[model samples]
Each structure stands twice: as structure tokens, then as C-alpha cells.
Target: AVTALRLISPSTALRNLGAATGIAGFIVASLILIFYAIVAGWMIAFCLSSVANLLGMSDFAAWLTSFGLWRNILFMLIFITFTIGIISAGVKDGIERWSARLMPALLITLFLLVAYVLTLDGASEGLKVFLLPDFERALSPKLIIAALGAAFFSLSLGVGTMLIYGSYISDDENLPVVGGLVTLVDISIAVLAGFLVLPAMYVALHNGVEIFTPTGALISEDTLIFTVLPELFATMGTAGIVVSFTFFFLMGIAALTSSISMLEVPVAYVIEEHGLKRKTAVSAIGGIIAVASSTILLNFENLFGLVVAFTTRYSQPVLGFMFCIYAGWVWHRDTLLQELRKGNPDVEQGLFWKIWPWYVKLVCPVIILGIFAQSLWG
Candidate 1:
């Protein structure tokens, strides 16, 4: 199967451009993993801490949740190591199997947590705020741009991760249908998450935890996961410990799933392009990312937010724009049509066949560039 790097065009120069795009994507993915691992480590730490709480080791649990440099580094290494171990085992045995098991578990846990949180006092207010959008604020260009970024990043659109994953799909699968289902699932999970988080925030406030500032902004908006939710759990007594454990465990699974894709982008590149063994690629790439993660941890005050903004805010949309260009303009139209026909011979008569070619070719590139320009200068 052709890798993402080779998917752009048959022409030599355009193929090199595709390779450069892939490399840029690899770099951005690495940068994202640097900080992403740190937060993922927090999820692991919180999971263990909840277990400690369950065992009545309150002090140990507190220390585990504390933002200690050593604790952060330890859990970060552990998370990266787990990622390496999984990818090293190869895709069918490692990625597919674990993802098959964990994703369902993650969803089940999310549903249960949402149900429980909604039953708490003040949760109705949160539900109202979440479901009832304020049109005035929603129309803000800034909010719309941010929303676009969130959607793209959440779906891993700009990254070669999805492109690489697509290469694994059998030719018999309908690409549009598969892509739609994936999008639906992703959006459902995100919405379900809001059902849990927003109501839980209000519940925390009801339990006397500080959730809002004087200006009505959320307190510790950036650190809400590590702060408000834990305090909210503490208010629930024994049940809180169980809930906290379940919640953090859910978070850990989510982190692991996402990190696997990010790491796979580069690992796939090295394995396919450099002729390296999967294990060697996983270890070398994972180790280098781990070192970069350590660097961020060491200089947390300075580099953390900078890297986050650079990768997610700036780099992602730009890469996504490039993907739109390659897909819509560079890739031959007949080839794309032929590829679509592999799964459905009558696809040419379908609505997607009629709309998508032009939509992706013209509409997608324009929308992506508009988003990029807004984010850049807005």
C-alpha cells in the first residue's frame, strides 16, 4: 500500500512536495506528543492516585496528583513506554486489538459518568448552558475559528495520522461511508464529553468548589481537569474515589488511543521509508519524543503553552490546507473516481460522487485557507 507520503501525485516534484508535507506533519505530531504525553501522564497519575485513595493511602494519592516535577516525568515516561510497547507489537496485534477493547470501554465509562453527573445538584443549569447556545457569542469569528480548529485537531485531520490509517483500509470499503461514520462517532464522543464536564463543573460549584471567577470566567480553565474535577470528586466521599478512579482511567485510555496515532505517523514513515524494523522505529522515535517531552516538563513555565499553540493553533490548519490542495487539485480526478468505484461500482451515480469532487477541490481548500487566515490574523 502507498504510504501518505506517496499518495499525493505520480509526478516526481509533487511527490517530493508530498514527502515534505508528510515530514512537516511528522514534526507537528511529535511536538503535539511532547505536551500531549505530559497531560496523558497526568491522567495516568490521577488514575493511580484514585486507586491509592481507594486503598486509604490519602497522602500518597495527594502526592501522586500533585504537580511534582519527578511525578510528571515518571508518568510521562511510563505513558510513552506503553505507547512504544504497543506499536512495537505491530498493528493487528497491538493497535487494532487494544483499540477494539479500549474504545468501547471508554464510551461505556463516559456514558455512565454522564448519567451520574447529571443527577447532581446545579447540573440542570449546566445542561441548559451547554445545550442552549447563545447565538450572539456563537457568531463571533474567533469562536467559529476556534471551533474549526478543534474539529480538525480532534479528528486528526491535518496530521498524516488519518492519511496513514486510511492506507490500511481495504479497497472494498466505501471511503465516504467509512469517513462519515468515523466523523459521527468522533462528534458523538465529544458531545457526550460536554454532557459530563459541564454538568460536573456546576456540581462542583454546588459542592462549594470555586468554579467561576468574579468575571464569570471559569477558574483554572486551562487546568480544570487537574483542579476542579478532583475537588468535585473529593466532595462525594467514598463514591468520589470510585468515580475519580473511573474518570481518570477513562481519560488515560483516551490519551493512550490518541498518542498511539500521533506516534504511528512518524513510526510508519521510518518503517516504510527508511527500511527499519517496526520495533526499532517505535523505540527510536518514541525515545526522541520522550526526550522532547522531558524538555517541556523541565521548562514547563516557558515551553509548554508555546509548543501547544504552535502545533495545534498554527501548524495544524496549515497542514490541513495543504492536504486539501493535494487531494482536490493535485491527485488525478479520474483516479479518485476510480478509487471510489472500488467499493461501489455505482458510486458515480451517487450524490457523493457528484458533489465531493468539486467540494473537496474548490470548497475545502477555500474554507481551510479562510480558517487559517482567520487564525493567523484574527
Candidate 2:
């Protein structure tokens, strides 16, 4: 769908985002990308922690505590360096190859972890909570609103990411089938993550770790991930180190997949617009991101929190609406149909094809606008 954004000026194809909207998208995306490294830095930090545990570093925690800023800088530096290197290697060798191996392995690791957690004493309760949604809470206005925002974020929709990847697809491939497959895999991973993490949460509770704060409210996400989960692993003794290492390593790879895609958007634009080589473009973008990430890392909570709120509360949903509007209204009706019909060039316009034009134009904007208004001002 996003391919259309890059499609109008088709010579560069996957290498370009649209003119005005493209710039707007990049500016909006810049916020999320900067803070996202902090999130990714957490993964790298945990992975390093796991490695230290494996090597029997007695004072690793003390060392990390004393040198927290520098330690984070190192991880963030490594993360940016490796991410830029991978993307600069070009799509087939870099993105696609790593994705082929990492995505499958990510799923397997998640399943195995889920299976292991399910064997714990309190696992069944976790499963019940995950599997059975609380309809009452779900029906609440707040929850419904959150779910709507979540849908956009989880799928990485409304970002030009889809457009970037869409340009990568070969013309002979069936877009609908491919899109559906990608979506299903994404949903599967989310479900599996819940299966894994929720069970671990219950297990943590069974081990007498607090899932909630002393004030009786739920603990913050950062505390749950960095503190509570590690405590859960501590209870398992020696074996937990290996398990924890594996879990964090799995997550690090998962985070890389998303990071690479985010980086590629601006990287592609630079390459096309400036005529720089892939490596040069990647380096330029990497340096920019690294500078931004370093500032956030150094500033810690206040600036980081502001960027997160801006991206989640304002930029992302707005950009998503823009993508929806452009797709539905700006691009010609026949063009979308043609793109959809790439693998099946002669496909007839049934009721679906007939209604879709008007649907995306009329329905999608209204729905997105409603969600955006609700999320921001409602």
C-alpha cells in the first residue's frame, strides 16, 4: 500500500518516498526512531548482561551501575553501527537474508520459551488471563481507545514503512496473499509473546515476586521488563542464566528487524534524493540517529517521555491518516486496482473491487479521524 507513495516517480521505485508527504513522514518518523533506540538499547543491555552472567562476572551489575551512561552509550553505539552495516549491505543480502533466518528463529524461540513457562506452577492462570479476554474491561472506553491506537502501532501502519517494503516486492508476486501472510505472521508473534510473557508473569507471582507496586497499582513496563523479569530468572538459579540469555538474544534480533526497517526509510530517501551510495547514505542517517539517540540517552526520562508521547499521541496516528487519505483519495482509483492486480492482471472487478474504491476513500478516513480525535481530544 505504501508502495504507492514511492510509485508515482517510478524510476527510483523502492528508493524514494513521495515529495511533500515524504518529508512530512520523515519528520514525524524521526521522533519515534530516536527514542526507539533507547528501547533497542534496553535489549542490547540485557543481552550483554546475559553474556556477563554466562561468563560468571561477579561484579557485572556493580560495574554496570557505576558506569550506567557509558555502558548504555556503548550498547546504543553497537546497535546503530550494526544496524547501519546490515542495511548498507543492500536489501537482498542484508534485510531479506537476516529476516529469513531471524523471523523463523524468533518464532521458534518464542514458542519454546512459551512452552517452558507453561510448565511453571502458576502458568495455567496466566494462560487463562491471556486466552480469555475480559469483555467488561475491554468494553470500557479507555481500553477500546487504547486498542485502536495499538492496532496502528503494532502493524507499523500509517508509517511509510509499508510503502518502503511494498516497493521491494517483485511484480509477479500476489500482493494480497503476501500482505495477508505478513500480517498473519505479525499477529502470530504477538499472540506467542503473550503466551510466553504472561505465563512468565504468573510464574514471577508464584515465586513471590511483586507484579504490582506497594500502592496496589500495576508496576511500570520498564520495571516489569528490566527488574521483575530478572528477579524471576534469579529464582531459577544457574539454569535461569541460560534461559534469560536466550530470551534476551531472541528479543534483540526481533528488535533489529523493526529498527532496520525504520532506518531504511530515511536512508532510502537520502540515497534517491542526494545520489549518495548506500553506505554513505546509511552512515549519514546513522550519524544523525546516533546523535539524537545519545542526547535522549543522556537526558534520560524527560525528553524521552516527551518524544514517546508525541509519536504515540500525535505524529503516528496523523501520518497514518495521511497515508490512508493519499491511498484512498489522491492516487487514482485505477492505479490501486492495477497494483492489486499485478499478479493477476486480468482479474475482474467484483463487488469487493467495486466497493473498495469508495470504502478506502469514505470509510477509512472517517474511522481513522474518529480514532485520532478520540485518542487526542475525546
Candidate 3:
């Protein structure tokens, strides 16, 4: 009966589904945070650590001890300048061009290391532990939630990032195909990152050193990739030096790409909403982010938690909900389907029109809101 209703009134069903999703509130919050602050903190942290290490710091902890607050402030300025310069150029000219050049090199380096790991003596054991899910092991509700969040977050979905990128896409581009490809690429990178990190960890364990567990660190997964992976690479002998260079080099690129998207959000907002020129808008936004980042670096404390908590609990989920609403509801289903069908003229409108409404309206929004509430309360 429900299937008949969906088939009979596909467009209306989709609209009703989108309305039921309840994503309108959270999506607005995400847009604001993305345009303003979340990505800036991550960029600030990346630049300070990357630049300092490139200059041969003994350790990040020791570098912090020696460099003090002003050095990080300086780092923030450099980071903002670098970010704004690239973002102001627009995505095709800036992001796509640089990514085209850099990503291939990064991938080749990572592949070599993965090949080496596969050939390692105890690699089979490490691979099994990572790839095979063991049901017997106690599954914490928290870890399951985290994994799901990571899956969505890491894909760069639920935010307007994909939508903004989509806007730049040519009419010839296949929407569904391109979206699926991007999702696959992002997931592959995350899994490859795990492969690169985990085998080296077990190698350390075998050699009688303490292995770091996910629960052992206060830092996020990205930080662990940046900071700790260098030490892991050091375990490999003469090849270690090359691996270290590749690891940090690849990491720097990943950090920069994500940061560029973040900076573009505000720069594009100003350009669209206000009549400001691109260069001028970039400068203003960059300066604000640099100042805010410097403040965070100088006084890392409870405020960090507060900012992060607010963004995660309210901002991210809201933005995600908003994106679905915008794409699913606000944008006419016929219009969206028309766009989707543009490059792929032979594509059928059967299930897409039916499932899409529920997905955008009722399903995704509720799941995201629930995740946010759970994060905040639990």
C-alpha cells in the first residue's frame, strides 16, 4: 500500500519524506560554523606542527616548550595567508589544479608503503586484525557511534561541501556517478590511512614497545596520523627516512585540501552576500580566522571544549540537516532529477524519486539530530 502511494505520487512522497526528516535547523548551523570557525582551528593546528617539524623540532611537546605562544601566533598568520591565497582563486583554478598535481604523487608514495607492509613478516596478522570484524569482542556503544560518525564525516558529506562543489560542476558532469566516485575515493583514503598506521603499530608491539590504542589518546584520528605516524615510519630502517617524508608530505596535502574547502565557504559567502571583490573578501576572512586561531593557540583550555562541543552538538548536525533539506526539499525534486538526468539521459526515475523524499525529509535528518543529541547528552 505504501509502495503504491510512493509509486503513484513519487514527487509528493519525496517532498513529504524530506519534510519528515527534520534537518532544517541543523543545516543552518553547519553553514554558519563552516563559514566562520571549525576548519580554522584545524588549519591552525596543522600549520604550527607541520612547519615546526619541517625545521627539525625534537618533539612537538618540546617544540611547544621552546617556541612559546607568539610562535604559534606567527604560525596562524602564515596559515591564513596560505589558505586565503588559494581559496580566492576558486575551486577549479586552485583546488582541482593543485590536487591534480599533488594527489597522484601522494598516492604513489602511499602505495609503495602499502606494498612494503604487505610484504612484511607479520603483516598477515596485522591485516586480519584490521580488516576482519570480530563479533566476540565487546562492542562499546560509543565506539560504534564514533565509527558511524567517522564514516559520514570522513566522506565530506552531510555538509554543504559537496553541494558547493556540485555548484561548480559542469552540465556535462554526471551527478550520481561523480558523487559515488568522490565517496569511494574518500573512504579508500581513510582505510589506507588505517593500513599505513596499524601494521607499523603492531610491528612496534612485536619489538617490545607500547602500542597506542584509540582510547589511549586525547587527540582525534587526524592528529594521530600527523603526529604519531612519523615515529612509526622510523621503525623501518634505511627505508624509514623515505617513508617518513612521504607520510608527512601526503598528510600536509590532505590537511591543506580540507582547509581550502573550509576557507572557500566564507570567502564565497562574502562574495555572494556582499558585493566585495574576491581578493578583499579573502583578506578579511583570513585575517579574522588568523586572529581567532591565535587566540585558541595561546589559551587552549575549557573554551576549546566549549567551541568544539557547540559545533559538534549543534553546528555540524544542523548543517547536515539543512543540506539535505536544501537539496531534497527546497530544490524541487523535478529540478534535482532533471539535473541528475542531464548527463545520463537514459537513467530511470523509478525508485530515486520514491526513496529520495524519505531520505532527505525524514530519514537522514532524524539520524543526524539523534547523533548530535547523543553526543551532547551522553
Candidate 4:
């Protein structure tokens, strides 16, 4: 009953709507992992390629980074196996333990990479371009939609991921404070990543790599990791090999951490709803997703972008809107206030306690709907 499907009112209509939303969320999470696993696998492959480069295996390293169905399948399986292995150990031993370790490691590596990237010759230029806002493009509908999608995806909102995680939290914890901390951390890492990537791109250009197309737009925005950064690393000699390995290793950690949560959304549903054991549920669900990843890989030219767009752009926002509606209109305010008062007795006096309920009920849904409508029509 802790699942998103069971989080709403007991009324037949509301319950049915909750079920539909939860199921939609599950599908969205699964679809996201399908392409996500492929990209995560690329991170691992790039890590290994760095190792191969260190060992002077030039041909093998190139093959690792090259596009091939078998390569994608092999690495994707490896990444999924790692995910399944962790999830099989259960939440405390698997998800929590690995996340606690991997996240700190990720931050450390990111800081180090950013520090080194800032020392490069063209980094300041990239920083200028990154920090200075272009007011002309600020109001672009495409930009607004893209930013909305990125924020939703980054926070894992509307997909029941936070809902599932929330089910595991202790009643003694302050939900608002925890949510605030999470938002802050997610934003911080995103900014840090921009620091590393944008500056590093300029550094690549400084090294004579083509970072811009003839029209002045960024070249290979989709493949920037595979092309631009690698070229920048190649110019660094021995240090590049180590930096490359660390960078990709950081990326692999990021992918694995995110994949764990995505897998958990469905795994929790199966174990609680269908009475399957954890290991059995993990293996079954993960295997099915692996098959989906393979299907995407085989039809990479067509399915990859389609799945990404469908899940993140369309499905996620709509599902998110439904969640807002549920939290705002269906759930009784008195019960919500009582729940919030669990950890903080004076929660009613707080700004969040005052604003959140109405905001979530009215403003949040309207904004989500408007943004979604704009995405479709504008």
C-alpha cells in the first residue's frame, strides 16, 4: 500500500486514477532505463577504453568507443548486471550502501575534474559563455520546454521514484527539509557538471578540435562526450589517460546510481503487489528491461531518440501533473497537516507548511499543464 498506486483516497474513481498514474509512471521509468542503460554502458565502455589506452592497446580502445550493435549490447548487459546485483541485495545493503559510497566518490571526482578543467587554456572563455546569460534566447519556448524536461528528469519527478523513496523514510524525519536538501544537492551537481563540461569544450577548441559547426552552433552536442572531450584528453598526454578514466568512471557511477532508483520503482511494485521475493523480482524485471535495452540498441537509429522523447518530454510531465492534482485536490488537508507534523510539531507555523498545500493543489498543476500545453502547441 506504500506504492504510488495506493497513496490516494479510497474512493473508486480516485483509486482508479491513482492506479493509472502509477502504472504510467512505472512504464515511463522502465522506458527511461532502456535508453539510460545504453548510455550508462557507454560510460563504462569509455572507462575501459581509457584503461586500454593506458595499456597501449590503441585498436582495442578505438573499438570500445566505436558504434556497434554487439558492443552496445555487451556493455549494456554488464551495466544491467551491476544494477541487478546491487538491487538483489535489498535496499539497505544494496541501494543505500552503494549510493552512500558512490555518490561521495562521484562528487570528489567531479570536483577534481572541474579543478583540472579550469586550469586549461581556454577554460575562462567557456566559463564566460556559461556564466553570461544570453537574454535574447532566455524566453524561447523551446528553451523553456527543454529546461522543464531536464528539471523533471533530473529530479525523477512524476515517475513515482520520489514517492517510492518517500515510503521508506522514517516518520521522525522532516519531509520538507529532506526535500529541500535533495533539491539543493541536485542543483549543485548540475551546476558543477556545467563547469566541467562547458569549459572543457572550449579547451578542446583551443586544442584545435572542431567544437563548433560552420553555423557556430555546438558540433556533436549529442556526441560531445564521445568526440569532443576525448580529443581534448588526447592532447594531454599521460595525464589525459588518467583524467579520461576518472571522468568516465565518474559518469559510470552517476549512471549506476540513477539506474538503481529507476529499477527500484518497478521492483517495489512487484514485490509488494504480487508477493515476489526481492531477488526474483529484481532478476525478472531487470532481465525484461535488458531485453528492452537490446531492442533499442538494435534499432538505435529509430527507437533511441523516440523513447527518450516520449518518456521524458511527454509522459513524465503528464504523469507529474496527475500527481500534483492528487496531492492537491483529492488528499484531505487535515490528514496532510497531521502527517507533516510527525517530525516537527510546529510545522503549521512554517512557510512551507502554509504555502505548499495550496501551491501543489492549484499553482503546481496549472504550471505543469501550461508548460505541457506550450510544449505541444507553442
lDDT (CA) per prediction: 0.89, 0.77, 0.59, 0.90
Tens digits of per-residue lDDT for model 2 on 32-85? Answer: 778777677777777677678778885885454233888878778888887888
Candidate scoring better on lDDT of 1 and 2: 1
lDDT of 4 at 241: 95
TM-score of each: 0.96, 0.91, 0.76, 0.96
300, model 1: CA deviation in Å?
A: 1.1
Worst 10 residues of 2 by lDDT: 9-18
**What tens-digit string does per-residue lDDT give for candidate 3 at 1-378?**
112112323487564544333233223323333333433334345434545555666487345424356655655465566667777776778878866876787678778778876776666667877889877553766565556565655655554455456667899887777877987888788788778667765664555445556677423444454445445545665465555555556655665666666666556656665779888987887776666665666565645566656655555665576565555555656766676677777555556555667787888777777667667775
Runs of candidate 1 with Cα error greater than 4 angstroms are 1-7
| TM-score computed on alpha carbons, candidate 1 | 0.96
Name the lDDT of candidate 4: 0.90
- lDDT of candidate 1 over 170-208, digit per residue (tens): 999999999999999999999999999999999998899
Which ranking of candidates, highest lDDT first? 4, 1, 2, 3
